[model samples]
Target chain A: MAPPTTPTLAPPDAPPPSTDLADAEPDTGRKRGLTGYLLLLPAAVWLALFFVVPFYSLAATSLYDPSGSDFRGYEMTYAFGNYVDAVQEYWTPLLRALAYGAAATLICLVLGYVLAYAIAFRAGRWKNLMLVLVIAPFFTSFLLRTLSWKLILADDGYVVDTLQFLHLLGDDGRLLATPVAVVAGLAYNFLPFMVLPLYASIDKIDPRLIEASSDLYAHPAVGFLKVTWPLSLPGVVSGTLLTFIPAAGDYINAQLLGSPNQRVIGSVIQSQFTDAGDYPSAAALSMVLMVLIVALVLVYVRRAGTEELL
Target chain B: MSAARPAARGTRPPAGRWLREHLVLVLGLLVLLYTFVPIAVVVLMSFNEGTRNVYAFQSFTLDNWANVCEDQSMCDALWVSIRIGVLATLGATLLGTLAAFALVRHDFRGRSASNLLIFLPMAAPEIVLGSSLLALFVAAGFSGQLGFWTILIAHVMFCLSFVVVTVRSRLAGMDDSLEQAAMDLYATPAQTFWRVTLPLVFPGILGAALLSFSLSFDDFIVTNLNAGTELTFPMYVWGASQRGVPMQVNVIGTVMFVLSIAVVLVGELGSRRRSRALSR
Candidate 1:
């Protein structure tokens, strides 16, 4: 909403002026290095207190259930079954999240990668202007942007009207609140994520390499398939992973754009802590999400060569 | 899209070659439109004077913008979010700078561990991370609802890694020699840092700070988890969605969006000027 969500990109600021600090300042015994450590202390303390402590507490909370009516602290029982019961309690939400995430990733890959490629390679002079457009939506509040989908997909909105005209739907328009709408929302919001990284990767790719492929008696399509795709695979991995991970956990679209019944684990977790007042179950649910995401990340890294991007 | 494609990519080749070269280009434009249309629809719809959605514009009015200002709750929530964003940015930037310095310059024990920990919040899904923080806050003996402190703390946690990343990348090129030279001149370490090293990294720090503020202001997930009774802009807009969103939400969103862009522009412009000076 506020920060343009392009992670891994360079900050617009030019490089710093103190480039020669290392070369100029040899580590003299007279000069103290602990000064840097002192500079680091405040942030370290903040992270330790706010970040590290809470995570450990969360991990601990996942193991316990309500002891009595007080519900103030953990019940003495360290039950691992909480995870199983939690998973069973919320399987539908979890599956729906995964499905929505998958659909969104697919759409983003289709649109975002293509856009990135075009802007990076084909739309050379227009790259910055086009990128500004691609990133423009993000400049607005995410909620506002998502709410736009509500307007567009409203039963009486232009989207339905346009689609109906194209005969993509029946006379009645019913795009809003559908799984498709949720997925489309996710893809639209996160597409710049896919596109930006891919643009960086593709832009780094030399056109001469593609020409070389064609020069070697290769079909144009073959050149693209063999040279371009493989070289750009790192971007694909980065972009897809970036899109898929967030889309999977997103409860916002499902809540606002889609039906409540289609709740993801995020919404489920939100209810557990806020509405349901079930900390143990919420903790259990969170652990499952963390595990699944980590496992998937690991598998993707192992199988799909994601480490290359890293 | 068709408007741009034929004009731009049509270096007329054989039909097969033309299609081959432009396939990604054509498909890419269509995809970008598909991605862009939803937000575009909203921005356009905000301009509609009519209440209901329809093909025809009944009239154009400033009623929504007027309504947004009139509503006290939205104003309160927007202010609360802004306060939190500013506070979150300040808190995160201070820590993030230190952390970034440590990660980049030091050969400390557990550096990798520190690095991974620094990035953990960013790496995970926002919900999970938010929930984890909420649980932590709850465990600290706060229950029912967390106040501003909870929201601010959560925002800081979320934005810290970003601050670190932005600052760290800039710090990568810092030559230790300049600091050594300053120390050799009998300047105290703090003086050398403030006058020499600090000025050099100030842009990165400011950029990181502005970036962090914008991100914190826009945050929904972590804030939702920890924000007990306190409502932020995103929280308000989200709640509004259940009932058809008022045009005020659009008004506020457009305003906030423009403001954040302005902030980024300032940061960028400042840096560009610095770069131009250095290059000269």
Candidate 2:
């Protein structure tokens, strides 16, 4: 799905920055040293004013407390209890979020790798059509994307109906409101993220390497395990991290497809602010998510050897 | 049976190149169909004549579309959303480009810190980001109004990250020699940037702009949280979904889909044209 906030190149397959800078070089004339700096000022100021400031406020509020549970606009509370409460209340959801995210990431990697393999090394001439189709679901309204699962996995829907017909069912034969649907929705929503990056990474792989391996004693499978998989690890790492982080916190898929028990931390945090009016607790929950995401992302980047995520 | 035949042939022994290609083509088509089916179903239901569920077949009618648009409130909400999207795009692009430049071009004090800060908004969960921003605003004496300004500010704050990322990618890929060569020609920093850097990264900037527009247009989670009493298009649709959404929502959704596709295609085409021109 296009990012709801910035929708810029869908976050995962955005062309790396080096591509654009190469375009600006004139063959003959000299380039300005400070000009790039000068040109970049507006963007810097904008980020500082809007982004840096708001987050500072978010962090600051984590250290605060409202006078009461009722909307009192917060009187600062400098303690860790809020964090404790947030953790205690929502840790299960958070863990569920992480597990779902990891599952989605793994599924995306396996499926996307296969899809990308077909497009990059296998398909020719028809490659663009395949890509267009891969991206087609993303072009529609996201609500509908999630809503499709409701149709497919609904109690008497095709999936359930088929299960019963195949004697793989019971009277209850319901797939709706299950973790399976929730995870599947998240996976479907993000599979393209995995595919696009792997496509780019795998597309650049040289066929000569495969032939060279085959020319030796290596089998095609062995050659892929050695070269193709390892070379595409960057794409895998980035795609997994990209899908996992959002899936961990996603509320929509859970809300639309899963049962009440399947509520992720995202929905809970949303409730604290909107329905419960529990601002302090919400702030603390937000902070916890922030800290966890930062920690996990740092570890992933360290492993992936890239921190180019926007 | 024929459709099945192609796939079976594909996996057959020795798998001649033709069979292999046929297998991929068939599988690719299936995947595409899987992706397209949902939207197609929704579109189909929009025209279903009966008031019952979408799954059940009925005679076709355009009445749902007519009823969906007949509401004055829906129009107002859509207008609000469009205005908000337009404003958010403008604000995000203006700021995002600068942040991208700082991230890409300069190696200054706290640069890494700044980069991390800008990136957090994108990486963090939308709920976390929205609640934090909403809380921060209220904590700073913000009143309860999900009116235009609040939504615009929030939209820009979130959207800036994309612009920054988009512009930064273009900037990173850019060769420093271009700027150095411009300096060698005796042009000032501002002039070189205007003549060289801006032109080169123009496609990225434009892409970022459209990206921001679509994002702001489609957003629900943040807008829903922050939209005090005001209703943007997505928010309205989500709320209506709770009680069963109208058919016009489908129409609006279709329209938005077409427009966004055009925008993406146009951005790609524009950049292609520029590159070809530059190469020539």
Candidate 3:
């Protein structure tokens, strides 16, 4: 779909180039008509039908009488007690999921920042190749990769053997079936999400600024803090959100790598729906999880001063 | 580059200087290697001989690769995933490309609202998205038909947001001057679009399509919730994990990894060559 353009009309004056496009106004001569709506109609309908409407359904489901089973068919009693029961029963897993997500996000930031910095400022001619390498691991299936982690952290694996040899672990200690493995899996799997955004942000920082800081006798560490770190905040915010949201919702790593003690909110939701057929509680838990994430994201975006993220 | 630095005077120890200079690069390479550790395991295990214990690598054998479809069910699941991935990619890309164009090229009321609508799906977690869709299906009485169509719908729903974001960024970054130039040359709006605008945005569309396919194929959480008895490759792998995982799973993993890397590398090389030609 193209806007009607007159051959004689001059193009609109270009705005000063800025990376942030969210707030930018449409350029002059943009079609101020029905075409936009028409173009957007199909997608809007799909999302409205599938994405937006589902939430309404979920909300209704959440309020269904908890005693109603899926096989017998749930009735919308508007009980609202499902939320109370869900929170009371599954609060531990929900909190544990958030904690694991936060821990993984923190690890990703440290590792992602270093790697992104190197790619942005130091890779030189090898920049593109390194970026490719960063994304290559994701080409593999997620479950397969997490399964590999299971093997890597297996009780009799080399990693545990080394840890035992170094006295880092007792003889009976293991990485698998532990919170550590689950968190590491989350961190590892989501590192690319962290790295790509951080790289995009860090790559745009003018090198001259860093050089000028050094020239002014700022130490390397001090310069990095003052110049590079603040400039990459947008990336950090986006990357951490990208990493944390999926990690928190993820059950695969927890299911495959951890014991029952390490079960997360996602695993509970799945089993509730599929195994227990408790639609109301499952729906309630999902709603709670979404609401919690949305609230956290709002507070986070406001605190980070990246209102454009919304 | 280092020689031009003021601090590169021959006062420091060469060994210490070298280590300090390359430290970040070394560290970055190590982290990159860490990401590949699983792929290495996957590739190695693809050649492993069968054993009751599937965690550790057994003696070297190429039988797994030779009999990649030893488990017929795994292959069936894989085919289902591929078909759904293709169809979902097409659906999401078509719809999302249109939305992206609308958001970028057209001035309209409630534009910010529409933008938020597109953004919400990406931000929402997969479990929530999956469950909500499942709720909708159950509510709509389509729960009995939950299979390929339900899985496809969920995939498209989730992937649509990403496609819109990806394509919108590309469209935003484009130099609109070329389209303006085409218009100045008396090209009709349709002509300008086909000859100038679409060509310029084609790379982004292609990228988004590839991304959509991969996302759809690799999806587990959302698909599993909606996939009533319909197993995809990831679900197969998940189920197998509870029992003993087949070595052939590694074979599929290795193939996907190699194939995608090859696609990416080829794209990179093609772009490099094009740039070289343009410069020349």
Candidate 4:
């Protein structure tokens, strides 16, 4: 979905950098030497100031005394206990965010793998067209997309009415304002994240390898399990990370699609910062969430046998 | 409905084999359908004539599209989002393209560190990035000043990373021999760069700019924290959503989808024509 470079020429069909090529290039420390640092200076400075320094500020803000208010300026009492307080106060949402994100990532995996596999292998000349379709929805406002789900899964909506008629749902049961709705939104929104990486890895696999495995008298399923799955591990690793991280932090789905009871940590942190004006607790919650995600990602990448996440 | 199997060489194809062969593709289409359902709803709802402020598609009409700006607040919010998006895109594309060029075409110390910094913004959740930036602004005594400038800062900050990553990939994938060949013709470095390098790299830069705009436009989380009282389009949608969003929002949504798809398709077709011409 990226724009073409030249006005007269179309961009190549390479997916955005969010997908493949994570480990494509290494720094050779070669060529136009002096100008490199000059060119890099503006961005490097910008990131260090805005991106890096904000972390320091956030950590400091998180340590402010619990008694602090937005009106009466905060004091950094080094109240590391704020972290403990954050968990104690909002653990349900915290845990719910992680759980929902995990569930959505898994669903995205199953669906995205099939789509990616199909596009990579079965699409032939239509591969590029299908890839465009994968990212088409992403261009729309995410909030609008979630809002549509709110419409579709409403009490009187077709999906809900059908389910009720089929006896799959009770008379008063509804899909809107439910955890299922939230997870479904997450899965839909992040599906492209999963599909792109899977396509990248699966597309690179040699068709001959699968044929060779089949010729060796292995069953198709066995061939897939032994050869295809293992080869696609890197994409799986990257795709899951891309999907899970954003899904975990997303509040829009939980906010618009699910009820108040489905409030994830993102919602809590948002309200604390914007509505409650409780910067310290919010900062503390943000820190905890960041640390937890980082720790989880480290363990996941290590286990997934791919450290290409940088 | 079944096709003829190799009757002489093999037994009848197992049902399981047929299912297995097409299962993934079928499931994939279903998933694609699932994704499109909401988009379809967005389009259909744009034509909805629901008088109530609830989430149901009542009768159909083009009133929403015709009178989209009847809600002044929504239009104002859209304006805010567009302004922020355009400014952020320009700033990010300029800075990011330079950084991308440096990383891909030149050697430098702390290259890995810069790359990590670029990647970290993307890897970090929006909540974390937003809250942290808000903290920075608040701490710097800009608590009251958190609106357009602050939102712009946050937008550019997040967008810079993606911009860098996008342009970096394009630059990295580029063949340097073209520039070398240009220089071999005794062309000056500046002329070769302007004539050869910029045209080649411009696509990636344009792509980065487009991405940055969409991201900035659609962003709500960071903007919510840093925007203070100013409402962008997404923020307006979020606020209005609680009371059942207006159909005009759906109009915007449908337009966005159509416009982006049109842009992508034109680019695709143009590239196809160019490649065909090149082959000829």
Quote the lDDT for A65 in model 4.
Answer: 92
Off by over 4 Å in 2: A1-38, A66-73, A126-133, A301-310, B1-29, B51-53, B66-68, B101-111, B171-200, B266-280
Q: What is candidate 1's lDDT per residue for A1-310, written digit by digit as tens?
A: 0111112222222333122222212232111245446666777677777777877777778888644222655774787888888887789999899888989998888777678878877775666567766766676777777877776777877779888999998996588778888988888788877888788788889887986776677776798799888888888888888888888988888877887667888899988888877887888888888889888878887788656333
Tens-digit per-residue lDDT, A209-262, candidate 4: 987887788887899999999999989998999999999999989988888876
Q: lDDT value for candidate 3?
A: 0.88
- As for candidate 3, its clashing pairs are none
Native-to-model Cα distance after best TM-score fit, residue A261 in candidate 3, in Å:
2.6
Q: Could you tell me how far off, in angstroms, the CA of residue B275 lies in candidate 4 after the best superposition?
A: 2.0
Model 2: how far residue A92 lies from native, Å: 2.1
Chain A vs native chain A, TM-score per candidate: 0.84, 0.86, 0.93, 0.90
In order, the interface RMSDs are: 8.2, 8.2, 3.0, 6.1
Q: Rank the candidates by TM-score, best first.
A: 3, 4, 1, 2
Q: Give one digit per residue, the lDDT tens place, for model 1 in B192-261.
A: 7788888988888987897787788788988888888889988887786666565666666667666766
Off by over 4 Å in 4: A1-29, B1-20, B52-54
Winner by DockQ: 3
Q: Write the per-residue lDDT of candidate 2 for residues A212-305, one digit (tens) a residue.
A: 7756757657988998888887777777777787778788888888898768888888888889887777778877887888798788788777
Selected candidate, larger lDDT, 1 vs 3: 3
Per-residue CA lDDT of model 3 for B1-280, tens digit only, reads 3422335635456677677668988898899999999999999998889843476777899888888788899999999999999999999999999999887777777777788888889889999999999999999988889999999999999999989988988887776777878888888888988999898788789889988999999999999999998999999988988888989998899999999999888888877887798679
Q: Which 10 consecutive positions of candidate 1 chain A have the poorest summed lDDT?
A: A1-10
